[model samples]
Target: MDAIKCHNLSFQQGEKCLLSRVNASFIAGKVNLILGQNGAGKSTLLKLLAKSQQPSSGVIDWREQDLQTLPLPELALQRAVVEQQQTMQFDFSVRQLVSLGLEIQLGSELVKAYQHVADFDVVLNRILQICDLGDLAERSVLNLSGGEFKRAHLARALAQIWPLQQTAQEQPDFSGKWLLLDEWNAALDMRHQQCFASLLKTWCAQGLGVIMVVHDLPLAQQLADRVLLLKDGQVFAEGDSQTVLQKTTLENGLQMQLQIVEQSDGKTMLLPKF
Candidate 1:
């Protein structure tokens, strides 16, 4: 069974259709990558799948039930979203901020204690390590680098999933959670990108589904199982990364001349030859 199934799902803002009759299924233990240029409604599609806004038509089914019918709390427990923009208005510490991710699944005590513990800090500590934010844990949010803050947000979402993972096993037949990361790659440098890609693949291996809206096509090619290419508010192509993101198709749909190239180190790369 598909983890997420969308049938004829469309959305609109009054007269303008942001998406049109989109049908696709997200499989378990895979990263479904959605790609498009700006204003191509990439974020809009993510919102529809996340059930943040009701679709204008069609249906979104998650784990056999209509997604709209699932209460917000149930949805929260089933999925976590990290949006493209994460400008926190609060002055919370980095550790305090990352701990916010576990608030939904975990209780109040350790979640709060996540902020100050220099020893045996549990989930917060674990995610700090996972997200590569260990050194920035004690820093004030207002003083962090942009990339650092994004990593903290990512850590929060990771903490949300990993710690609660044990409980899901106890509750067996658990409809595993899906991580929806929108433009999550924006701030990462080369090193972090590789790290994040590795982490995502590992998460999927452990039974979580990852659906990401990524503008970076090469990364998507390397990491995605399914690539959905959106253009002018419609699905231009949807299939394996190798098939849908081919040279001719990408060039016309994405309005850029893209060439698949091999690097000096012999690793493959997708760069615009234009």
Candidate 2:
């Protein structure tokens, strides 16, 4: 079954329809990539899916349940989001910040808030390694670079997403965890893209659903199981990576020239050498 779904989705901002009648399905255990030009409603769609903004039409169905049927806290327990920007004006250590996902109370002048969980350390370490922030775990978050800080925030969300084994009534099965990672690779170099892709590959294997919005078509070609191409607020094409990442749509969508250079190694790549 599809992990997350949008039905007749549309969002309007007064005189403009940002997105229109869009229906999309994101599969579990696979990397589903969204490709679109600027102003094609990629970020708007993500905001709707994230529940940070309400859709002007249609609905979001997470798992088999309609998101409208669930409360905010329930939705929070089911998904984790990683946005394009990681803006923090406050100072905090990377370790402390990541641990905040464990429900640490905000410290006040009267009393310092503290909460402890034995599982937090394990999860934090695993996420730090996954995001390549293990060494930076002890560093102050305010001192990290854009990419480093973004990875730290990503790690925090990943840490929260990591499954825990509790003996009680069994916490909600994260087998339904919807990972909405948007523009995570925009600021990183090629190497970081590969690293991020690798982590998505591993997490999906463990039943995490990844809906990644990316502009790097070549990387999407290499990493995604399927592709959903958005053009001018509509779905221009969508299918297996090969079908959706075709030469024609890739060019038309961006109104730019491209050439599909086929390697002797039986690999095809799109280039702007036209």
Candidate 3:
């Protein structure tokens, strides 16, 4: 029951229906990838999950609790979201920006109280290292390259839900924590992509639940435990990765011929057949 479940979910803008009756469940402690062409309501569904936007109809439940009824302050401690486009108007340093995520979870007052604590520094430093932002920690957010900026925002989100009270020797329990990402790999190069992919797997192994919207079919095949394919704002296919990411299912849902190559390691690879 520790999952994100949507029942008959729908979203509308004027007369346009962005999503229609999308009933889906994404389990905890695994990577859930949402795939679709543009306008397939992928971003809409992610926003709804993040509670950044309200659905016109239906219910979204987190661990069998109605998401809308949860207090925002309480929810901030349980989940974090990273969106595709991030714009910063201020000249805060990378460290400052990442610390703001902790502030959101702990509130301004608690942040001021804990800013100098060893635990706070430990959590912040670990996130910066994991996100590859340790070197850029003191640099102004305005000066970062696209990839670095993306990593900074990701570090911030991680800091939001990071377990702050755990001892250094204790394994951090990420159960009930969720990370919602939209196009998380967009600005990263191949090296960073592989690096973050490994990091995601490690975190999920530690009980972090991830729901991501991505266009990378091969990456999804590599990481997804569950895959949801969308078409025309509806659930075209939803199941385990091996069941939902087949060549025929992808071709029909995406309207293109794609090649699926089975590697010697038993993993699959996808390629566009253009």
Candidate 4:
């Protein structure tokens, strides 16, 4: 199965447990949203799935293969992650930073050797356009506004797992590739957020798998195919969005009084009562 599975997953720092016995399966080619209040271990679980932090106990499997056994380079090709915070020490241009993702896909040495190849330029240009960073390609990363910087990083991550070898006639296949995002909408404005939602819809339909940790319930309600609710480092509930995001389940899990309103357009809206 092309899926990410966690079994008895737990994480701790010293004596403080951040996650406890988390077991879940996220299918490929779908949007999976993790929702919770602050300090609910949402980011912790995302880190574990990205393999950036090892679980103190239990295992994570990618396509039925043990995550720990995969080589770092191979894993890099199969997955890309965008964290809540981004920091850069060097003064690299947005184009340069984004190119690093391509370097990971095709070795740095090869990129340095053939930096001006036609195919490389094609892929990079497409990614820049998809991420809406074409105009900022040459801008210094340090000079970008918060929203611009976030989009730049998103473009880079997308470049990391882009199907570079596929010919123009071949359909893009992202069956084994995964994108893990943590608070990706933090700096993005409403317009950009909508653009991102549309992009995810298109990519997921083309076999891209996405797992994101977000606090935006309304956006999650619109984008998620599967929803996982975490509370106090545990899975309070999880299932298809329609099944898990009911009024009572969300209220109990998030400790908030929420109203689910049905619009004339036949869309559901989640509103929190103050």
* Residue 12 lDDT, candidate 1, scale 0-100: 89
Itemize residue pairs with steric clashes in candidate 2.
Answer: none
Residue-level lDDT of model 1, residues 5-102, one tens digit each, is 88998888989988888887787788998888888888998998888889999999988999988988777777888889877777898888877776
| TM-score (all chains, Cα) for each model | 0.88, 0.89, 0.95, 0.95
lDDT of 4 by residue, 1-274 (tens): 7899999999999999999999998999999999999999999999999888999999998888999998888899989999899898789999988988877876657546666667887888878987899999999999999999999999899889988878856766777789999999999999999999999888888889999999988898889999999999999999999999899999999999998788899987888877
Between candidates 1 and 3, the lDDT winner: 3
Instruction: Compose the digit string of candidate 2's lDDT tens values, residues 133-238.
Output: 8788889988998888877877777766666654424433447777888898877767877888887787788778888898776778788887888888888777
Per-residue alpha-carbon lDDT of candidate 3 for residues 15-131, written as tens digits (9 for 90 to 100): 999999999999999999999999999999999998989999999998889999988788888899999998988999999999989777656574465556556777888789888
TM-score head-to-head 1 vs 2, winner: 2
All models, RMSD in angstroms = 4.0, 4.1, 1.6, 1.6
Q: In model 1, how large is the Cα lDDT of residue 178? A: 85
lDDT values for all models: 0.80, 0.78, 0.90, 0.90
Cα lDDT of candidate 1 equals: 0.80
Model 1 ranges with Cα > 4 A deviation: 107-120, 165-175, 263-268
